[model samples]
Target: MENYKIPDNLAVSEEGFLFLPATGESFTLNEIGKIVIGLLKNGSSIEEIIERLTEEFDVDEHTAEKDVNDFLTQLKNFRLVEEI
Candidate 1:
């Protein structure tokens, strides 16, 4: 995967929140999203992301799987993330 190419229109707002521009929608992220995005910026792997999230959020594996998939899907749908 091309690690450097984060979606052009995706950015953290002034209040440090993620925003997806294509849909004119805003996402007020919890700490998990913030940390995940930071890791993504540093080219972290999906596996690494899962590990970090699980450690930080105290969520079980199954719940983490579902939430990560759902979040990534939404990002993909809005073109806020690219698979590379």
Candidate 2:
């Protein structure tokens, strides 16, 4: 499994608020998003993320995988995270 990283220009707050200094654009995320970002920042692998989500949220592995993939795709689309 590979890890993902949030770029330095992307600032994240305790309340799941994300800000891009270069573009002056900001976005807010839900609790789950915050957890995912935190885990990514901590160098957690993709599989680890799915496992954590399943355990914490009581979701099945298949559903967790789908949601996590969707969330990661959104982050990538917004240029918020990079494959590392």
Candidate 3:
């Protein structure tokens, strides 16, 4: 699993609203998305995120892994996260 990073110019609210200062773009995240982003901001690896998701949410390991992968893809597509 790779480590991901949230850009320095991006601001994320407690309610999962994301704003990119450079692009003047804003996005709202779902609950799971918010958790994933927070974990990424804390420098958690994908594996760690999966573990946390499984532990914190009512999800199994395989399901959590799949969901996290899908979310990561979305983050990449949105230019919100980078592999580092």
Q: Which candidate wins on lDDT?
A: 2
Task: Please give, for residues 1-84, the per-residue lDDT of candidate 2 as tens digits.
Answer: 556899977899999999999989898999999999989888888899999999998799999999999999999999999998
| Candidate achieving higher TM-score, 1 or 3 | 3
- Would you list the C-alpha lDDT of every candidate in the order shown? 0.70, 0.90, 0.90
The sequence of per-residue lDDT tens digits that candidate 1 reaches over residues 1-84 is: 223235767877545577766777776766666766777777787777888878877798778867877877766775666786
Where does model 2 exceed 4 Å of error? Answer: none
What would the C-alpha RMSD of candidate 2 be, to one decimal place?
Answer: 1.1
Candidates 1 and 2, the one with greater TM-score: 2
After superposing candidate 3, which stretches have Cα over 4 Å from the reference?
A: none
**Candidate 3 has which clashing residue pairs, if any?**
none
The parts of candidate 1 lying over 4 Å away from their true place are 1-5, 19-27
Q: Ranking by lDDT, best first?
A: 2, 3, 1
